[model samples]
Target chain A: MEKMPKWADVILIPAISILLAAIISGLVLLATGKDPLNALAIMFDGAVGSSRAWGYTLYYATNFIFTGLAVAVAFHARMFNIGGEGQALLGGVGVAVACLYIPWPHWTLALLGAIVLSGIFGAFWAAIPAFLQAKRGSHIVITTIMFNFIAYSLINHLLVNVMKPAGVMEPATASFPEAAHLPNFHDILGLVGIDFAMDAPANIAFFVALLACWFLWALIWRTRIGYQIRQFGESESAARYAGVSPTKIIMISMILSGMFAGMMSINNVMGEAERLVLNSAEGAGFIGIAVALMGRNHPVGIVLAAILFGFLYQGGTQLSIQAQIPKEMVVVIQSLVILFTGALDHMVRSPVERIFLALRRKEA
Target chain B: MDFLLLLDTSVLGTTIRMATPLLLACLAGLFSERAGIFDIGLEGKMLLSAFLAAAVAYTSGNVWIGLLAGIAGSLMLSGIHGLASITFRGNQLISGVAINFFASGITVVAAQSWFGQGGRTPQISGAARFDPIIWPGALTRIRDLLQANLSTKIYSQIISGHAIIVYIALLAVPLAWWILYRTRFGLRLRAVGENPAAVDTAGISVIRLRFGAIMIAGVLCGIAGAYMSTALQAGFVREMSAGRGYIALAALIFAKWRPWQALGATLLFGYLQALALRPDIIEKAIGVKVQVQLLDALPYILTVVILAGFVGKAIPPRAGGEPYVKER
Candidate 1:
């Protein structure tokens, strides 16, 4: 079999898979008696039709970037960190404690403090599973999944029994101080004499996500430790022969993975909600898996993938609300995208490879 | 402390009841993992089957039909997993994740279209739901056989009065042991996991064996789901299986992929569920505060501890997640 060109491998394969997904999703809509064109139009309008929608889309994308990076970083170590949901949950707790306890005078200071705290929290949550996978024979997938459940229960316990103020029936904790509430894009843009949506949750967290993309790119490609992680991920025996410690690589990879996941809470907890709430991490954790897979586990690929998913999420919600499509149908579309790009990838690859091979054979 | 309440037959009954779903799912995972396919969509399969069983049973007014439909639904999904992973040689984990999302979305959409009650099936009643087996007039028989002792009768009640599926689930452990260890197919299955090439050399088709294992896993998961909707409860609800599938996978790991060990692990988890259901019992008995959520988290925490403590023993099958390829 002939190896495909890098451009095709990086761009064309995902594009074809996604196109196939869109076609199949259209068929699914048609089968349900909904107009595919109408659904498509509604989705487009909902996602990027206006500045407000873009705000929601970017806000959602911000969360996905953190989680997607979490999965991608762990992927470098060949570790499928399925515990991002749990790690992100734990990150929320860190944000809650930091925001609720420390009274920062400015939003900038609070953001910095939350970053450190969330990194520590996310890293701590991921460290246990990483440590177990390194030291014990436990599979990371299984352990991380189990940890997701534990994280949910822990967060639930804290919200219901510990954090809720007295006489409040609601399970969420009290709102954070004003300093902790990060400024949204509208607020920032307003300062520069530009009009923007006021209530949109899109905040400085999106910039942080972009920074993370750069950080990951540098960490994976430019640094010696990054080289060691890649080597360990590619082949443990090769790394071990080169005197790299397996335990250290595994632990560090997972901790860094967790830190990224935890930082996601800064977007939801501090940026938008301005308080700790149950399920603030939402399904962004699982969506991260899809993001990582579809992005081919690359930082640039992940950023683009995050934006695409963000569009889908916002658009699907709009379709469901306006077009009366079932809310779960969006999930079905998400599944199809991953199923084609990640699971059934060879379906597109082998045919392309065969064509390329045939062309070469013809030339010969 | 009301020790008696804590030890009540009703509590034990609830534990056994709750354990039924986990037990079936654990067995399902054992079969799949033992054949070298790491099937993580057990929850999805269970959820699908649960929905089908309840929907069918409610519509047909026949619990048996519901069970069959549920099994078929689950098998269909497992077949997809096999096609993707075994045939196309895709990543089993990703395929499993995809199918899970598929099941979650499709079921809710189908449910709403079919029943029109949000994402729930109509509650089943009469002959559609499984009731206690009763074991051929046990009240009179027990009185005559046991001289009407309270403890003896209560003990029988704890052990008996379960739906027929519960007994089937319990009996399956030994059956799983027989097929996995004693049968020729069992030997081939084990060999396939350890080294698929060796199985191929021995004139056994690795694809067929693995596909069969995946199908069997599906059937078992279907039963697990059907039991929940058609037996334990009367209808299906969205995300009804919750994370019982993951709990089962954890139990399977805790057991190290042994059938009998799977039973022990599942029952232990079931006990934890029971404790979670009634945290006050623990609080009263131990004279300390008990967090139900923490109790719910025990399986995950214990699995970690066990993994760390017994690292060597917990290793999965050598080729569990790798897609088997013929010699090239």
Candidate 2:
């Protein structure tokens, strides 16, 4: 084989890794007496085969995008926000309280109340750990993970007793009223021969997430605070000497990260599900870490990574139905992406840097 | 209505039983993290081990062998983590995430294929279980006294009969404490986590030390899983670790990565769990009718509250995540 060009390693590494993973999955399928091509085809078909499937896929992608952005933002601050689940949980609680308990005559007011409350709740949930890290010097990883558990049990209790609709079998609150339901635009579009469930609820939230990403990009690359955060991330001592308040930065980043997560849940509570439910976001928050890593902590990169995950998620379900495979194959694929990305970090960096340097030299 | 009588036994039992798995997991985390390896994947590993312990016990008709199998399985996964993170200089968080996702997928698939069990394994037989060893006279009296009553009765009722694993878990605490504080190995392990280069200069192998710690964590996690499936519940269910591994991790953190401190944190969490489950007793004890939901959230709420308050200055080892690269 021709020796791979040094510059090409940047792209080749992941491309080769993904191909290797697909081959490995293929082999696993064959070993289990399944056709690989058929599985792949079904996965694609299921994800984008029909209008309804595409609609649902869009809805799923929308949620993933927001949470993925949340994770990405924290990663930029060099803080791992694993409490995305907890933050989202509180967000849902906020939305539920706003919808069920708040006195609202107008639909727009109710919607605004729910969104604002969700963000506040999420920020509050995350603020505890942020406070610990800022003031007490607690490790972000463990503290955030612990907080996720607290959120789960706390929500479970509240759902079972206080918030739950009586006679409900599972731990879920009452559905919001019709006025509170965010319209699935796809369903409305159905009257004009354009219908899909996947992206039905795709609305202003997507734009908001995109806008948030842009804002984060500008905040990270442009502003003084962004420079201080990067400086702190690089060397805490130096950043402190430079007059940046490390504690304040830690708290602010965590709260901001968490607020973004709160907005992510608005898709479910205000848009798709229209009610608070247990295990909401499932593990999307965790998946956001993978997105952040794949995106290389770049805002635009996160958008692409989120979309890729969305495709895998949609396609994986299709493959499962078609090939009688477990949909968890998608999870395996995701784990592989993270594994490859992490393992190939060196490859992605030096080669790309070298390429840029060589191009600059040639131009000069 | 003699409600107090019923309340005490249930509270005591729930506290003891609920605390057992958390204790085991916390101890496991304490050991691993003390040596400076992040063990966020404990829940996934424990779930895998628990499922396998139940499966092997159900199949081979030997709980001892099943327990061993679980320990071995966890060790293998831990070894992978050690190799990937320690030897290869891979990211710790990524490796943990991989181990968790891999364990979850592989265990569920294996269970689905082997036992044709959907979401859970079939309940195992009595022989596979760890039965309590009941003793005579004083032990019997102690058992009755400790049985869920809220009187100021302090006796040795705890030794009446619990599965052998329960005693082992309780015993492991002191053993871990001893291993951590008294031994030369413990000092070296701490040294390795704090500063691997210095430890290396001191002629100790950081790689071997960290690997050994990770493996020990795996073995303890295996026991924790075994207790969860056979002793606590009769069968293995999907996600049975149910984030308990993570809780153990929390306990370890709450204790600040110390073996001895973990005992207090785990028990506190257990007490909270017990309180949640036995809300009637809690209500009466506290003299307030707390909504059961709030009661259930006691452990989590307490975790946030306590962690927020005390974890303000719990500094980890200086070279915790940085991989040791030997100079040429």
- Strongest candidate by DockQ: 1
lDDT of 1 by residue, B10-73 (tens): 5677788889999999999999999999888898999999999999999999999999999999
- Model 1: which docking level applies? medium
Model 2 segments beyond 4 Å from truth? A1-13, A16-37, A97-114, A157-204, A319-324, A327-329, A343-364, B1-10, B136-157, B181-183, B310-315
* Deviation of model 2 at B275, angstroms: 3.1
Q: What's the residue-level lDDT of A323 in candidate 2?
A: 60
Chain B TM, per prediction: 0.91, 0.88
lDDT of 2 at B231: 78
Model 2: CAPRI class: acceptable
